[model samples]
Target: MYVIIVYDIKVERVNKVKSFLRQHLFWIQNSVFEGEVSRSEFQKIKNGLLDIIDEEEDSIIIYPFEFFSEVERTVLGVEKSPIDEIL
Candidate 1:
């Protein structure tokens, strides 16, 4: 499965969250990460994120897909990501 992770978290825990996620996903832009992982790995990601974020003050959205090709995207300006695209 492929997953796109977007997080809105407190500044204090931002680095922790980013470092943890960097071990598993591609950092496409600020607070946004996307990549493919096994089902078990995805579950671990969920559990790990839960451990790192405060439920009361933070929010994380994960979009899971069967295939990355299913997405339709448009870029309007200069891109800041290290990778041009993932498909």
Candidate 2:
């Protein structure tokens, strides 16, 4: 499945979280990542993030795409074309 993972974490642990996510997803924007991951891989990624985030202060959101073509997007400044590999 295609996934977009966004995180809001304490500043002190932000970089660590980004690094951890980079292993599983493409860093699309600050604190935002997107890519394709298998169900098993997604579970692992969630488990890994659970280990690093502070429940009281950190939050992570995962959006799964059943079909990339079904998504409608709009961009203004710094437009980044959709990654071909993702299609």
Best by lDDT: 1
Query: What lDDT tens digits, residue by residue, belong to model 1 across residues 1-86?
Result: 88999999999999999999999999988999988899999999999999999999999999999887875557678666745565
- Which runs of model 2 end up more than 4 angstroms from their true locations? 80-87
Model 1: C-alpha RMSD to truth? Answer: 1.6
RMSD of each: 1.6, 2.0
Off by over 4 Å in 1: 82-87
Question: lDDT per residue, candidate 2, 1-87, as tens digits?
Answer: 888888899999898899999898887777888887888998999999999999899999989987666556676688454555455
Whole-model lDDT, model 2 = 0.83
